[model samples]
Target: MSVLDQTRVDRPSPRPRRLSWTVSDAAVMIDRGMRHTLRNGDALFMSVFLPIMLLLLFVYVFGGAIDVGTGYINYVVPGIILLCAGFGAATTAVGVTNDMTTGIIDRFRSLPIATWTVVLGHVVASMARNLFATGLVLGIAVAIGFRPTASPLDWVGAIAVVALFILMMTWVSVMFGLIAKTADAASGFTFFILFLPYVSSAFVPTDTMPAALHGFAEHQPITPIIETVRGLLMGTPIGNSWWIALLWCAAILLVVVPISSHLFRSRTRV
Candidate 1:
């Protein structure tokens, strides 16, 4: 053998790199999640259509009765947008619960990929699904005289707030799904989320509520989020609401993501 060949043969082989999760793995999970959302016709229809119905109901049936010192349609549209986003994101809990209860997660565990991608895929897919539904609702709102006075920058800000809220709500739904024993139970857990807006400034000003209800509405996380979005979209005064909303989202994400990851690992570990 040549001297160089002998030296190369004597050297130790390099260790194989350990396989870890990658963006492609996450993308595959996301794709799977999106496909699941598409395949569930009833869920897709309700997530989009239910909010539209609520918008119409509030605008026509209740708009004249509620006075917010502005066009009721304009005032109520922001709340409906949040409502639409919340209900759509709440579906993530059902999906996650289904995955947990079914044997599919076990199959996923048998693969070499990180198990957390399953959760992340669901989260991203929910965000995408909710954003689409929100846009549809917003479009319908516009068609029915929901005129927004927002500038281009304000529109961007409003979108950012909505997206942030959706992301936070999706993760919260994931957490609920993780904790629930059954898909139905998981879905039931989201009812409070859907109901939260009604008590917040989403449908009416907080002060209009009785004193006890007003305190709860003014202090809750959803109120700030709705207010920030409303201010941005309608060019209303945002005050400190934008930061408060961002902080609420950041705090929830910070707390929930880790707990979710831990729960995923704990539940999946065999």
Candidate 2:
């Protein structure tokens, strides 16, 4: 062998230094993202407006004649809350999709940031937005005479259950962001979400539909979720329905997290 070949064989291959960041790093990333989202007043307004308008339009306008079993607003509020959770998650897709379309995510990749934090940061921000929307909807529900007579602990449990659903849905949005070709397509994901509340017992009683349709709707994912949540609020027995809700949330998490992370790596490839 030549001298160069001998020297090449002798040189040691260097390993990349592993990065070890503190909890503060994740906290800082989350806080920065949260602030950016809160600063967008227009976005905040639209997020709050859709559900509020729907609540008003339905409860006062069409709700009078629609006997949903718990009166108008009382029956409608929980369904709207679930819809609100889905709506809030869609914003995550929109924001992330916008960034990907505009090369902002690529720019973030070049920065000295934890790349995993990029998506999680957006998720935390979306959670904050959903929290605001949930609060607003609950306020409207109470004002419209939708009193939830649950104990404080049960109320807190309801919030926690809803929060899990929000996170799960937000992760789905992030997956959409990774895969969507256009912003409009990203926004269109909301259509499927919107269809869910209607197909379930959000706006009306399932018994009002035909027997076959009622059977399907009652067993589908959203019905048990809405039932358990509304039941808790009404001081009625949540039964096995709450466990079913938790199962749905857990199942979504198990499936989506891995699939989304894989797609995320492929799309970013950094």
Candidate 3:
């Protein structure tokens, strides 16, 4: 062969461009997640079931006992939304753990796809699920007695806050899933996220708790988020809760995303 022909032959075919591969790979994985979600009736049911049941139980059964100013349903629905977000994000851990345990991550790693796309796909799907589940809970609240008094901008702010919380929790759950040895362990890891609201201003004001518990409840990450959402929806003074909540979400995401990505790489390495 001529020199130019030899040079062309020796120059390996250009590997496929990465950005396009990442997008397509992430899209495929997202579709996989969506299919998993759609086919799993139990998962979908559980996503909304716990939050609705708790909302009903609180509004009718325990609501009469708890003093949250006017209507207890209105007071607790925001927290319920957050709870639903937590539960939804927790499922990502289970899914990721399942993928890991099943060797799917290894298969993906073998492909010419961006490393982050695998986790990104899971994160995007989880965010959609959280939004849908939260919306369903919100609709049910409206059907019952919950009425939010926020303006258009306030609603926007509330949604942005919820989205940030969802993203933060999703990243954290991804880490949990990657680190977990089993699916059950992964699921169990999110128990604290689910229960964090109970110690916050979700059901009742933090002041009602005992002194030490009160301090913790007042200071935990969930309290400010719940308070910020409540204030936005109820037209109450938000104070600095919104800023604090944003910072918490940003910090969690900044810390968790990279760690989770690294853990995923380590756990999936051939």
Candidate 4:
């Protein structure tokens, strides 16, 4: 064979594509998200600060007015935890919206990578941040007067519920991020999510609410999730609240994930 032909034969071929590449790409995006969080320390500071401030204000200012049979702090801590998680997840919308508007997403599209990796990265980072935020709130609650009778397994279950809830919310946030023209608009979508816990059994009992309000509060997604976390922590009978919460989370993911994916594609089309 000629020298040129021998050189061609010695050259390496391109590697075969594998499904596992998605995981690696997602990790890169996840790292990008973590770096963003670290660079903007204000994000972490605000995320933790708001929840802690709320915990203090509610436990001290309004604790006397709310009655939960047990200490009000203990009763409300679970709800506050959910609130913290929601707040963390809301940042995903802002991040996505900023990227969309700033052309970062367009740059990503030009790369040889799976589209879903970017979304997954945002979600994983958001979940990590939320878990940290919730843990901080729980620690503060414990420092005050909150106590729980939950076992190790119950604690695991509570964590799982919160994580799943965050995942569901992150997808919704992604959709809002894609649809929103401004960061403020994208964030506005989370107002209802942040408010939902209050209307539910988070702050006060549903029975204390008026008839129609009570019905609505009892049926809302936040109620079961809050109740499930509260029940798990308090060692109260969870009954079907955990299952109901899981179902709600699953349903939200089922509906919103596709819509978010579609919106992302439509909006990012070059």
Candidate 5:
């Protein structure tokens, strides 16, 4: 045989590139994220613990002075649940930032898997973590006298809203993570998220605030979401707040998801 023919015969075939993501790939990434959560004792503890402490603090320490035309525990529990979910989701920023800055992303790029799955994995893990923390907060709230008058359907609606909010916030955190240069910066970026609930109708009625603050609080994204959850859980008047809350979440996801994708590509580009 000619040398050219021999050279052709000896060459290996090219492997097909993974242009699309698979469920299994996403699941593997999710498992990695969950394992990280399990190994990080301090983060897991604080994610669950801080919300519980805040629940106790607000319910016992501040519940007496705050009047929302209901038992303070009942009035405050929805806010606490959102707070728990927000705090849990915020941790995703730190996790994603760590993965980005630690050279693991480069390792993953060498594999045949879709890189976006890494972010998806973090998002799903954050949702799961936040949901678990939210459940614990609800249980504690009930134990501490948070009584809800909602029917089964209302309970379902409330849960759906909470889940949607978690997902939206998780994406936002992912974007922040992608943008931050360090884990500390990522964590710092989420402080705004953690602070948002306090400014809304979470802790008190927005109307009770001064004119300037009340306008901002009532119009901000968090207030409508808190109002929707409160309405679903407590049988309070929701008005148009439910749909408005949904629209807010949808808008945020629409904006952030594409931005996150772009940032991920830019950051990982060789």
Candidate 6:
């Protein structure tokens, strides 16, 4: 064959580039989220002040009479961390709806950024808020004589589980936000998410309640999470509850994350 023919025949196929995401790109999105949260001052209040207020009210008043084997503060502190996360869910819905309503998602889509960046940004913001609130609640717990016998690794693992549970539920809230026809409806998703814990064993031991109530309470999503957390902090046997909590968190995230992203893209058009 001629040299020219061989050269032409051996010409490389143009590679189809696959999209990539980076730490710097995620950081840019996260910083944008931080700025957005700062601009919305109410988010800080909800994330920090409200949880602190509840901690004060519960520990000083009702906490004195309530008994859950651990110190009252210890008993409720984990739940409060979950509450802080629930509060994050409210912020999630509001942020998503506001972005959609204000055409911010459209603006974002016009850029060369990752499509998943929007969800990642909101999730990071929620994680920041929940982490801050969890730290504050732990401070209060320490002040009220809540101590842990568990090792630092155990505590870290517990915190990681709880934080992830919150993130999973926040994505559920984000899902509602994307498909919500009105901002009011979007905000209401958080209300129900918050209420689920109330009906669970968060405040009282499920076995000590009425038979029917106990049965339902023992099986609820929050029960396993609360039991797992309480076990870690108090050195109680976790039994199967830790695995159960993780499974529930995984199930929720698996169902909600992809579905929420799809709904978000389909509805926002940007």
**lDDT tens digits, residue span 152-184, model 3:** 999998998998898888889999998898988
For each candidate, what TM-score against the reference? 0.91, 0.86, 0.91, 0.90, 0.92, 0.86
- In candidate 6, which residue ranges exceed 4 Å CA deviation? 1-24
lDDT of each: 0.89, 0.80, 0.85, 0.84, 0.88, 0.78
- Per-residue lDDT of model 5, residues 13-51, tens digit only: 457654444677898999998898888775587568989
Between candidates 3 and 5, the one scoring higher on lDDT is 5
Worst 10 residues of 5 by lDDT: 5-14
> Model 1 clash pairs?
none
lDDT of 6 by residue, 1-270 (tens): 556654436743555323444456678888877787778777777777887887777788888888877687777777777777777657788787777777677787776666567777877888887787788878877887777676898899889987888788778878887877777888777667767776676776777888988888888888889888878877877899999999989998899888997887777563
Ranking by TM-score: 5, 3, 1, 4, 2, 6
Between candidates 1 and 5, the one scoring higher on lDDT is 1
- Clash totals for all candidate models: 0, 0, 0, 0, 0, 0
Cα distance off (Å), candidate 3, residue 144: 0.4
Per-residue C-alpha lDDT of model 1 across residues 106-199, encoded as one tens digit per residue: 8988776777889989998898998999999999999999999999999988998999999999999999999999988987967778789999
TM-score of candidate 1 on Cα atoms, chains taken together: 0.91
Residue 33, candidate 3: alpha-carbon lDDT? 81
Ranking by lDDT: 1, 5, 3, 4, 2, 6
Runs in model 3 deviating more than 4 A are 1-14
Off by over 4 Å in 4: 1-21
